[model samples]
Target: MSLFKNVLYFQAGFGFLANTILLFFYTFIMLGHRPKPTDLISCQLTFIHIMMFLTGGDICLTDIFETLNLENDFKCKTIFYISRVMRGLSICTTCLLGVVQAVTISPSTSLLAKFKHRLKVYMTYAFFCIWSFNLFYSSNQIFYVGGFTNVSETNQMKVTKSCSLFPKNYIIKGLILTVSVSRDVFLVGVMLTTSMYMVIILFRHQRQCKHLHSTSHLRASPEKRATQTILLLVVCFVAIYWVDFIISSSSVLLWMYDPVVLTVQKFVMYAYPTITPLIQISSDNRIIIMLENMHSKCHKILLNMFLPFL
Candidate 1:
């Protein structure tokens, strides 16, 4: 494979592994194998990311086997359709995760604080609603996109390097346009608002406690670390999301297929999926606990075997 292809595969592979690790951690929490409040929204978010990476793999494989789908419209539509839905679901889940975390740390007097009592239940319902909405909304992709060989006026048939959506009627086209734009705007807006609110809250709390310590710098508390992680996620997300949005919007508005634009967009979309889990694992004490337990168990096993030999 070429360097470009190698990068895409590696990015998708690493993201897939990260999501798997996160899923394993969340699954343990949900199954009660681990002692933690079941964070339903976070579980949903990780699941969605896992699905996104899987669908991306499917797309990548499709690119490799282009000969099979070179003249097949159905094969093209199926891949793109799955991709659009997963992409939409991923964005919605990310926004929901941000909003849930924001509310979790909201001040007791704040409106979001009212949710503190039933946070898990509320988040469960919220995730269900998000999944339902994304499924129905993105279903339009079936009619909006497909594989086709378009013959230009000069009489040459052209197969697009990347699948492109071409809605049949103005109404379908308008709906797709509106939904795509509005979805991104709403999700990005929510993420920005919630993450900033959280960062500010953590900052204020840190400031209040500053005087209690000496002039030496201190390690971040769990809350502060969580806040910083969220902020980093938001920053990475917004930077990549807008760049992907611009390239996608340009592709849609201009109806031009640029290989460079498509590749860059793919890379940008992978950014959050690759980074978020690393931050989660690094900041979470659960991983440390698991590691410590494993170390002790292994030490005991080794001692038993060696002692018996001695």
Candidate 2:
């Protein structure tokens, strides 16, 4: 395999592992282990990221499915549609995560505080809406994308070795582009706005804590740590997302897909999903504490076993 394939495989493997761990952690919490309000959203986000890797692997690692003898059109459309829907869900979930966190950390008297009690209900409704919208919105990919059969054809833009986007009317193509752009811009805008709100909240909170206690005595709250983690995720997602977006949009508009450009775009596209779970696992206090306890248990067991020999 080439270096690009090697890298993609490594990324997919690592991301899959990280996301699985996160999914299980959230599952454990949901199963009555001190669950929090944001656990549901976080769990959903992890699931979406996991699906992204799976769908992505399906597209890039075609060798895994050679025995199925699936038609190219079916393979392309199914994979592409699912991938697009998952991508849409990823952003929408992340955006909702940020907004929910902001609401979660708001002052008791603040306007956002009212939704805190009904947060779970709202999250459920929001999730349903998000899934429905994305499933419908990404239907366009099913119509436009297909397997590349004619190597001589210049009208279609090849996305992968086998999958290409069939040409559509310019007006229809432009409309699709506009809708996609608008959706991304709206979601990104909400994420940024909420992030700013969170930053202010954290700042004011720090000041209050400092006033109440000395700098050395003050420790970060769980809420503050969660907010910081979400903020970091938002920043990382926005940066990587725009790069991927620019490349994809440019490719669509220019009616071209250079190999090098596609490789770089793939890297950018995978970066966020790969990094997100690792960040969450590392930053979560509960995960850290659980890991510490597990380590302690292992050490104790090893010491007891060795003591008899010693």
Candidate 3:
């Protein structure tokens, strides 16, 4: 195996493991009793966790390119179709999450704030729409994707199934790229605008507090904390995703079939979802306290166990 393939496999494995742990943690631990059922932010995080799992699966599928048998053309097509759909949905859902967060943090005077209360109510419907859009848009891949047998003789492989886009269907490929790029651009704009608004608001609030005769607690306010967390999340999201998008876009434009490009793109694409759990844990005070409590209890238990042996 090539160095690129080895790196891709490692990334796929890590992403899959991280997402799986996060899914379980959210479903069984973090999601119970603390956050209200009607909390839009909580629902949004749950949806993101699902997207992470799907993305991890897509990465894992790409990692196994060398091991997959190409005997059945139908199976190859199915794998390609599913992988494309999942990857598309992952990107779409991630964009939706950013948009939703932006709206959630908008100032009360802002137009987006009017819809804040409706986030939980509309979130499920929005998720459905995102999934449907990706599903339909990616259906073209089902018809165009082919195994190694259909690819050029120079790139043919043994004991490996390759999924390649048909050169004749350049129009469909263009459409896919357009939609994906447009969606990402819109989301990035929203996040940038909202983050800027948040910074301005925080600064103004600090100034007002300083001018007041009576001292007021501003540092520990929940609103301020949430804003800070959101800002951090936005920064991380932009840093990881912008680079990945650039790489993917460049690869498409150059029509490069290099395994190294694909490998880098795959890792960068999935890294965001894998690392999201740590971001959430760090930002959430309740989770942090719970973790500290658990650690103390474990320490006590270990001491007790060693006391008997001593």
TM-score, per-candidate, Cα-based: 0.82, 0.91, 0.74
Clash count per candidate: 0, 0, 0
Model 3 bad stretches (over 4 Å): 1-6, 29-31, 34-75, 102-110, 153-161, 211-220, 296-310
Ranked by TM-score, the better of candidates 1 and 3 is 1
For each candidate in the order shown, give its overall lDDT on alpha carbons.
Answer: 0.71, 0.86, 0.62
Residue pair clashes in candidate 2? none
Q: Rank the candidates by TM-score, best first.
A: 2, 1, 3
lDDT of 2 by residue, 109-179 (tens): 89999999999899889999999999999996699898787747557788887888888888998898889
| Candidate 3 lDDT, 1-310, residue by residue in tens | 3776777667656656655655555564544655432234444444554444443434444446436664545556666666566665555554555566657656788888888887767777877887787678777766655655644554432223345544434776678778777877887787787678778777877777777655365443655676676677677778988898788667656655566566677678667666666666676676677668879999999999899889
Return the TM-score for candidate 1, rounded to 2 decimals: 0.82
Better of 1 and 2 by TM-score: 2
User: Mind giving the per-residue lDDT tens digits that candidate 1 earns over 1-310?
Assistant: 2677679878888888888878887787768664332256556667767767766633454655466735556766766666677788777777776787788678898899999888778877877887788778867667756555453532222224544456356776687788778878888998988987887888777787777664332453765666676677777878877888888777766666566666667778887778878877887887678768879999999999899789
Provide the global lDDT of candidate 1 against the true structure: 0.71
RMSD of each: 4.2, 2.5, 4.5
Most accurate candidate by lDDT? 2
